[model samples]
Target chain A: MPLLKTENVTHFFGGLKAVSDFNLRIEPGELVGLIGPNGAGKTTVFNLVTGAYRATEGRIIFDDQDIVGLPPHQINKMGISRTFQTIRLWNEMTVLDNIKVAQHGHIQYDLKDIFLQLPRYRNQEQAIEAQAMKMLKLFNLADHAQQPARNLPYGQQRRVEIVRALAANPKLLLLDEPAAGMNPQEIEELMVFIQRIRSELGVTIWLIEHQMRLVMNICERITVLDFGETIAEGGPDDIQRNTKVIEAYLGVEDEEIS
Target chain B: MAGRSGNLFSSIFRPVGRIVSPVWTALRRQLAQTPVLAFQLGVLVAVLLEQWQGEAFADLLGFRRIPRFFGIVDIFEPFSDLDFSGILAPFFPSPNNISASPLQDSVQALGELATTFVKAFFYQGPRAPGFFDVTFRVLIYDIVVFVVPILIIAFLLRPLVSELLRRFPKWSLILVHLIILAAIVLLWGDDGGTRELVLIFMGINIILTVSLNLVNGYMGEFSVGHAAFMAVGAYVSSVMTMWAFVDDRVFGAPALDPSWGLPVGFAIALFAGGIAAAIAALLVAFPSFRTRGDYLAIVTLAVNFIVQSAINNMEGIGGARGLNGVPLWSDLSWVLLTTILSVFIIHSLVNSTFGKGIIAIREDEIASELMGVNTKRIKLVTFLVSSFFAGVAGGLFAHVLAYINPGNFGILKSTEVLVMVYLGGMGSISGSIIAAIIFTLLLEALRPLAILKWVVIPLILIVLMLFRPQGLFGFREIELNWGWQKAKEKPEVSGATAED
Candidate 1:
């Protein structure tokens, strides 16, 4: 069975239909990509799936539960975690705290336990801290563990955001334009990083990217969205040759200026 | 003479300090780790010393005399007929007795001087509240009622709070709170009434600043109308006290006996007022879902206006004229107790992992939600907690003033709280306290300035905005006796876990 399956998911922002009848499926440990132009409802699809914006219609079955109307945090707790299109790290928090806070769903202690500093609170906090540290070590970002997330370079901030999302132990990871504004070198590093996370952590990956090089090189299967509709879906090689995908990215010939 | 004395003290204390340094450090660490334990051990030593040597001996050590709070001169009273010159003749380096070699004389003199220094730990005399005032029974009352429980709670919260600036003041803060409490008791017990009133206002403002700081500071939300919640707390508590406990003109007669009302009614009423304000906070909390910055701020302002007008329309609770006969039960101790409790709760709340979620919400609401932070629930809880304390502050203000009006809880009151929050700087507990204190004093000093104080306050805000928009202690805390806690803590390094 697919780890994530969305059937006819639809969303509207007032009169503007942001995502129209969106449907996608990702098997366990598979690397999937969603690509679109600027106004193509790419991020909107991620929002609907992550419950940032609930779908107006259709079912999002994740781990077999219909999660269409659930809150973002609840959806996140049910093992769907996403990084923002913009790197939104808590600027003031330490890199370690940034990762540790993502485990908010996993924290087992109540307020009383935290207030009293009970044994349970102590044990869980240590475990969470250890997990965060391990993730940092895995990414070779351990040296900057105590540094504020804002102080890191933009490329590292993106990496930390991914590390933070992974800290939540999500079954399926959502990356929204993770290579946005990244230099070619950083984009190359991110492609390697993305594939590594998929292979090692065994989490299914779905990402939206404007960078065609990174997308074509890494994504096994690609889905293209344009104006809230899926224009194309297939292997990366097929998507690269699809005339409609090319037309969507470059825009249509205008007979006259509106 | 001053220069010579300073030189003499430095010269005399250098080696003596070296000899006792180890003991001092060990004792200080003990004080930090287990204050209650040290407190008990101190009592044991005091009782043993009192038995070993007479009252005069303990008097020189400064416990039984000097800065006495209760006004009872103990048997070890320092000003009694004890001749200090007779006891110190041997230690005095008499010029006529300049004998033998200079080195031997110097060593002997040093030893005698150290012996004399050990004889007097604290200066002996009647003076203002300072060291040794922590030895009084009223201090014990202060400790048992306020400081100790807080210390015990601090002990319980040490691990989480052990990080950051909170770790620095561990032992010294006990003394800091002690001095405040003892000073409050000292001032309250005395007939000098103006100082007492200032202390009470200071305590109330501290609560106002710290509580609002939760929303405005740590959470980075613009809460323009905190005083509405304060007003809710005041009116709810006032009505509870007036209608049920005290015989007021509005309520006619007391429903409960007036004697027990002062004690029992105030606690219950303050709590109820806090709850009412928290419920009232929901008015703004809902708007918070879709509004922020200037928009969310307007919602807070609207809540302020609504609460004031709502209170204004209540005819039985003295409508436009104001609440009268609120029993005047909020004294120095009540204000102090409530302030400490408020500070403690906010400190713990901010220090906890749950509190981190609040900070996370402040940093990025969307990001926090995506990371599994329940933004809606956290926002609701934040509003509830922040307003609840504002309510409590209002309750105290009402009782202390013995009257409150809708006008009292207006936009002007909210401005005053905002000034303190910003003046103290945002997100710093110690900053809020210092700002509250300084702000209270400034308000009183500018009482003669009348409406012009508003102009001056705005000037200060403008000056602050141009320079330090974060306020005096924004995002940073003042560590009490930081020099005393120079020992750095080793961060626990967990070995890397094998991936599943």
Candidate 2:
């Protein structure tokens, strides 16, 4: 059974329908790709699914529970987490702190425990720190644990964002242009990392990617969008051969990128 | 190598300076100490002299009890009783009385000294005979007999207890707190009398500073309407107490009419204050929860003004004329207990997961929420908790002053509380304590400056904010422990785990 599913989901901002009747589904442990041109409502779909914005009209179900009106954090607590396309991080906080913040949901310390600094507070903090460190080490970011999030290089910053989101221990991970600013070599490595996270960590990957090569390389199945509407969806070979996907990519009537 | 230069210089000068250095150094040391010593001595002497001679002058002027300062005494009568022989005696320096009746002279001198003290204080100025005199008397009754002593004890107890807390951890700390509470209750009683009033003000100030720092300093929310919430609490608790006192009796008048009604009133006052402030917080939180940085600040300021104006026009709660006769319930002990309690509560809150949520909100609200923190709930909880404490403080304030005017609960009071928080340090509980103590003292010290006090206050604030905006302690508390030892202990992973 699918872990998270969006059915006929659509979102409108003023006069523009940002995403229209966008339908997607992911079984547990399945790695899927969401590829589209600029302003194609890819992030908008992710946001709508995550309840960052109300869907103009649609239903989003996470683990068979209707998550349409739930708050973002509630959506997260329901086991769905995501990273921003522009790398939204707690800039002033240390890398470890950023990850630890995400771990707040799972903390065992209640208000009483914290206020009194009871044994529970002590145990919870220690446990969370270890977990956060392990998450950091997964991304090879243990060395930069004490450093501020903003101080890291572009690639490492992206890695930190992924690590922070993953620290929440969500079953579903949404990436919004994770390789947006990376060079070709960086993108190639990111492909492997994404696959490892899916296969080894066992998290379902739902990503919106502008880079065609990365999308074509790793995605088992691809959903293509254009002008807020789904123009194509299928295996890599089907998307490569589809005439409609070619027309959506190139402005011309019948054209495609090599 | 660094110390060797100092040693080399000192060794060379040691022999040569030994002969003349002692005398020269003594002279220079005396010269150096002169200005500081002189300034302090001058101020003390002036105050004591003013207290004495002013009464003497009043007596000579044939005034009975020079208004507020001296009691009814005729200073001029003594002078008038002196004969020409006695007048000459002052100049001649009597040899016989100096030795034989020296004891008798000392007794006469003691009477003269008392007369001098009363007279000096009396002639300084004539305050209003009725309301003014009563107010002055009340102020004196509270400050001199109560606030001063508690302040002295707090000054002595703070370091001693902090040292004990550092050494013994929790149990000893609790014992010290119990002792303080016991002492406070013993000295001031729990009644809403004059002693209670002073203690409550001191206590509330402490609470507001520490609790507010959790929001303004630790959570980093700029809240200016603290007094409005306080007013809410004061009105609520006062109304409830008044209701309980009056309604339970015939025709809604106090039945048994216990003198301790003020303390009872204050208990309800805190409850009412907390509830009302928490309710009021919802308005500001919903609209501004999604927005951070400057936007959230603007919303809180607006909420503050809204609450102030609402209270100003609120007829049921007294409106502009303000509520009267709150049945003076607080004393120094009650205030001290609550103050210590407030500090402990805030200290624990800031160190908890809930506190971490608050700090996360301050650090980055969006990031906090996105990480599955119920941001709205957290903000609401924080506001509610903060306002509840403010209400308790307000209840204490109303009963202590035995009156409540809208003007008293105005923005200025809020700013004063805010200053205490800022002066103490934003996230530092210890800083709040230090700031409250210093701020209260500074206020007393600058009282003589009158109208110029505000000008000096702002200037001092500007200087402090410029140099130490994070406050004296920043987010860290004034822990008495040696860091080296705590550091040596296998990193308290439990404490670290709690942060997450």
Candidate 3:
């Protein structure tokens, strides 16, 4: 069975359908890309799967559990974590604290243990801190761990978001516009970073991006969405050549898509 | 019979309701938009109405009379009869006895002034027995009364509560609550005096400051109407206790006597107050979903006014005249227990995973929700818990004073709590506690200043705000650790650069 599956998921905000009949199936440890023009509902799909938005009509099954109508925190606890399209690091918190907060769902100490600073609380906190530092080190953010996240440069903030997401030890990680504001060099670095996270952590990755170069270079499978509907789904090369995908992006003959 | 009575009630009020509904709605809308202005307007209207109509207006509303504010002299009454000159005679050698020169006399006078100021700062009034006057047996009695319960609660009962919390979770809070209540009753017996009253007030203030800090500081939501919750708690609990214990009350004969059932009645009253406050908070919480920061501040401020007005108009509970005959069940033991419990609950809550979620919402609501933190629920829960404790503080306040008035919980009361929360540094529990103690002490210490006391306090506050706006602790949390243990551990690093 697939590790994650979404069947006939549809969502509407008033009269406008944000996402309609969105179907997805991902095998374990697969790195996939969701590509679309602005307002193509790429991020909406991530939202639905992560339980940030409940599917108006469909099933979101993660690890054999139907996650429909579950709260986002519970969904995260179920081993699904996602980064935001806009970098959403806790600006006032230290880089380490931002990552430690993401690991909140997995912290195994009760209130009593924490209040008394029991061995269980101490050990778990230390372990989580150690794990966060390791991820920070991987992203070259170890030195910056003590600094407030907002103090970091834009590119480093994006990296910290990914590190925070990974800190949750999610089986399936979702990245929403990770390269939104990065320079070309940073984008290249992000591609390698994405690949390294997948290979080293053995986590399934799904990323939504407007950067075609990063998507085309790294994604094994690519799904194209347009006007709240999936237009094409195949390998990256097939998606690049598909007429429907081309039409969705560039528009057919002189007829504007919008 | 009930249906007929209800119908009759509606029929009698229906026409009046129709006439007043539109005006009330318009007033409410105006109040919602600019609550501070509405509050000022209400005060102005009240003052104008009082001047224009005088006793007639008050009589029509069932307001017997406005109670006099407790004067500074009234507060220092206990100390007035005592001869403090005797205590200070040895500290400052008499110029007459020493045959001192003019300069030496002046220096001796200065020394006497310093000693007097120190005494005033530490004074608990002369009514309470002095430390030296109490016999060794009484000392042992005091120690046993205070320490035995604390030791039992902390050592024996705490582990059980902790275990229960881990296993049952929901039951643990109740278990802890019962333990504290039992300990309070057992320890306090029937002790009642000015020192106990002051300590109880301090405890309640600490609870208020810490709880308000939860909403205003940790959540980064500006809530300046915390006293409204306290008012709700005070009124509900006061009414509950009055009904349960006090005879010949508005609600008729007493349901329970003050003798054996007083403790139980007080406990129930405290719980009722907390629940009532939580319910009141819900009324504000729904609006808070769409509003925040300055808007939320206005909403809370309006809530404070609404609650005070509602209470003032409630003639059954004494209206503007204030409720009296509330049994004095709150002692230092009860206050101390509740304060400790409040601190423990709030501290544990903020440090837990749930606490991280709350902090996350404060940082970025949309981002927290997107990250799966359930921002709305976290916010609601935080508000409810904060208000619940505020109500608890109010209940304690009511019991300690044995009387309550709507005027007692005005905008000024809320602002006092806000000051403590901010002075302590929002989000810092220990900071709130320290600030609350200092603030309370400062208020008491300035008692000798009379009306000028207010000026001195505000001036000090202004200086503090100007210098340390982030508060005494800022955003730094004091983590509970076995001192230096955390600092000793070093992070293991592999030799690899970012390029590698």
Candidate 4:
């Protein structure tokens, strides 16, 4: 069965149609890529699916449940979680605290338990903290567990965002420009981490990347868009040779790298 | 010689302090490094000793005693005297009717005319009908008569509830709270005597501070116009109570017997006050829908002025003089109980899902909404709930003062509430409670300081804001577990290392 599906989803910003009739489907545990130029509605599609913004038209369904017009948290609770293109980590909190906050939905502790420090509250808090540390260790960030998210380098912050999203234990993960400003070494490491997460956690990933090489390297299948309309969708080799995909990426003409 | 004697004693004690150095060190270190549980017990013991010692000293000094001692010298008696005739005599000069000759009478007449004009424009004359008269009139209403009986019954019912709480092991700690509050109120009672109205005003201030904290602190918003909402409540309750006591178009007929108007009036007034506050909240909610943060604060402040000016323009409600005949509904018992109840309700709300939503909003609005929280609805609900409590406080205030004017609910009043909230800490429930008690006590304690007291208040606030901005307890509550307690045995952690 298709895990996450958007049917004819359209989003408009007055004179411009940011995302129009954009549709995609991913089976359970499949990894997909969305790539386009700077103004292409790749992030807009993510926003629509997450309920950050209402789609101008159409429907978003996840795990057989219609999720259109639902709030982001509700969508999150429905087993779909996401990372921001610009990495919106809770800047003031510790890395562990950031992860802990995302786990607020899963934690069963109430105000009574929190204020009185009831045994249940204490046990749950301990368990969550332990889980958060484990998630950090997976990303080689256990050493920076106590450090604030803002103090970390951009690459590290990006990883923290991914960690927080995973803390929700969602079945589907959406990554918006996860490799926006990474050095090649960091990108290679991120690629490996993504693959490991997919293999071990058995979750589907839909990633939007601006770097062609990284998208070509990691994405099994690519969906290409230009000016709110999908132009092509296929394997990496097909996308590389597809005339429209090349045209969308290289301004109507391929400029050879010297 | 006295200085040397003191030094000699200290010097001798120094060795004693040092000779048992290891033992003292061990004791000091133990105290310094005690677990939270041990520290809590020590604090409880210290608090009890301090309270006992304080009462003993007051008794020795001929101050009013506490815990069933209602002697003539009881600290709060003078505050309940219900008289202010003495203070008004000086500001309001009388007309000189007699003169030696016709020409002299004419000259004196001119001066008298000038005095009359000045008094008319600026001063509230001594003989002019004021709060006392209105209070007396309201008291004659049946509503006024109904209040005391109800209060007595309510007070009687309290011990039963407390007993229930005691039986439940979870609420045993709440008993500690009653003791603490009693200690505070008794300790801070006015010995020098203040006007009954002023005392009532102080009580209302406590109500406003604590109730508003539920919004600004726990829910996380900055409210600048709590005073406006109080005024709205005051007007509503006062008008309704007035109608019940006397014939008015608003109520169609008198709702209570003139003989018992005060009691009846007070009850009606409380209900009206709540409705008025809710209506005002509706006005506030519209602006809040689009504008947030500082904008919301500015909107509330404007609402205060709007209510005040609206009251001023409405001639039927006495214009600026304000609608009178509000029965004196608030006594020490009433004020004390209301304060306690407000604290309890707000504390519980902060701990509930509704309260957690408020906290979540305060923590991060976008995140809260993204988590499926209806941010606008929650804000509105809290705003209205807060207004309801503010109304209850206003009704109590109006009855206690006997008379109120539009000027009573102004920016200055808002500032006072703000000061209490800030002094208590923005989000700390227990902090607000302590701050209210301390703030009231400080105002009384520094009465001799007069204008100098305000300068000191600001300095203290500045220091506190700088050093402890999150407030005394942050968002933590003052839980009174009255009877709900647990087995004293500590749970052993076998494997975990000490956090320190």
TM-score (all chains, Cα) for each model = 0.72, 0.68, 0.65, 0.64
Q: Residue by residue across B1-500, what tens digits does model 2's lDDT show?
A: 12334888877777776877788877555444332222222333333443556456445434443422122112122222212233234444666654454456556666765564454444424531332343445454335433444344444444454454456655554564467445434433344443344345556788877767777887787877788778777777777666555443212666445554556555555667677766776666777767656786677666667777787898877778877766655667667767776777777776555566777787777667777888887777777778778877887777677668778777788889889988887777888878876786566545444555677789999998898877777766664432123431232222132111
Candidate numbers sorted by DockQ from highest down:
1, 3, 2, 4
Give the best candidate by TM-score. 1
Of the candidates numbered 3 and 4, which has the greater lDDT value? 3
**CAPRI classification of candidate 4:** incorrect
Cα lDDT tens digits for candidate 4, B321-414:
7766566567765667667766666665554443556766776677655543456766887788788779888888877777888998998888
Q: Which candidate should be chosen as best, given lDDT against the real structure?
A: 1
- Give interface RMSD, per candidate: 4.4, 6.9, 3.0, 7.3
**Model 3 stretches astray by more than 4 angstroms:** A3-24, A37-41, A51-71, A104-147, A183-185, A226-231, A240-258, B1-200, B240-272, B290-299, B313-316, B452-467, B478-500
In model 4 chain A, the worst 10-residue window by lDDT is A249-258
Candidate 3, residues B289-403, lDDT tens digits: the string is 6766798898999999999999999998999999988877887777777898889889878866557777777898766765656577778988999999999999999988887
Q: Which residue runs does candidate 4 get wrong by more than 4 Å?
A: A1-3, A57-80, A90-171, A179-203, A210-218, A240-258, B1-168, B183-203, B213-221, B238-276, B313-319, B351-356, B359-364, B449-500
lDDT by residue (A162-210, candidate 2, tens digit) is 9888989999999989998999988987998888888778999888888
Candidate 3 clashes between residue pairs 3 or more apart in a chain or in different chains: none
lDDT of 3 at B326: 83
What stretches of model 1 exceed 4 Å from their correct place?
A11-21, A108-126, A226-228, A237-258, B1-192, B447-455, B480-500
lDDT of 3 at B181: 50
- Between candidates 1 and 2, name the one with more favorable lDDT: 1
Model 2 misplaced stretches (Cα beyond 4 Å):
A106-130, A137-148, A151-153, A183-192, A211-213, A236-258, B1-202, B218-221, B240-269, B280-324, B422-433, B465-500
